[model samples]
Target: MTELSLRTRESFDAVMRKYADMVYRLAYARTGSTFDADDILQEVFLRYIRADKTYNDEEHRKAWLIRITVNCTRSFAASAYNRHRDLSEPDENAGAEDPALKAAETKSDVMKALLELPEKYRTAIYLFYYEDMSVAQIAKSLGTTETNVKTRLSRGRDMLKEKLKGVEFDV
Candidate 1:
């Protein structure tokens, strides 16, 4: 095709490579389902390709992607199909005999506890801790005030502490 089309395609590919993992991780953290996360990833990038907005910088582009990913995950979770889907309980076994396996088990427990949290709290915790995003950045990405992000982080941490009381989670 034209040079402009080729350049645009290259730019999109680079953007996808740079942010795909971040988008997938955020989506997975929000939904607690790999399938849903994959679907959201595709949708988020589709939206990115369709958007006509101009980014001020790479950080602005990243924030825009984060916002889109969050919105798409929320919409996907709220869809009638997802609402009617059945969620199977995770296996409740600590069958780890080795140190590495035990560590895996601990991580599994922490993920379970994280998944048990409310959407707002989980999103706040994930963005803050896992993504290394500041409260101000999270607030802008989530379309909330920094105060609200701080409150959510505090409440979410308290909830996580309570949920993982017997576990050795450092978060």
Candidate 2:
């Protein structure tokens, strides 16, 4: 177990180095602001450090971290909404300067459309497309059946297509 501790620390460091950007992106997609996403990332790692010992396996640990991140983002959104008495708006600079910024801008329009969706559909779409989770994984993460995830994904995509019909894309 002593060796495992060292290996876990090494593995954790490697994972953070490799996937930190991915985590931030996921958090940003969920929270819509770099500042809030930064906070969420920190909170996710803190939770990971204090996580249960049973998640000794790497895959289990990664899933646990993602779950914590998603939960924290949802909680933050709820609290922000309660405090402001309005839906938190997406940051205007949500997509700024990546090579794919133009494509992302189109997607951001879709995301804005997604913001109009009920939380269930919004989360399903974000997890399925942006986070690339499978329907089964999304269902497990959301505590729903895979069939429900599929239904939500379908509905969300249709809504996005409808909302984006007239949006002009630069590219």
Off by over 4 Å in 2: 1-7, 52-58, 80-84, 88-117, 166-171
Which lDDT tens digits does candidate 1 get at residues 111-160? 77787799999999999888889999999999999999989998998898
**True-structure RMSD, every candidate:** 6.4, 6.1
Least well predicted 10-residue stretch by lDDT in candidate 2 = 1-10
Show model 1 residue runs off by greater than 4 Å. Answer: 1-10, 84-107, 166-171
Q: Across residues 1-171, which tens digit of lDDT does each residue of candidate 2 receive? A: 132332344556565655577677767666555667778888777666665345556555556666777788878877855456455554445466433334445656665676666667877887777667788888877678999998998887777778889744221
| Cα-based RMSD of candidate 2 | 6.1
- Clash pairs, candidate 1, are none
Cα-based lDDT at residue 160, candidate 1: 86
Best by lDDT: 1
Clashes within 3 Å, all models in order: 0, 0
lDDT of 1 at 41: 95
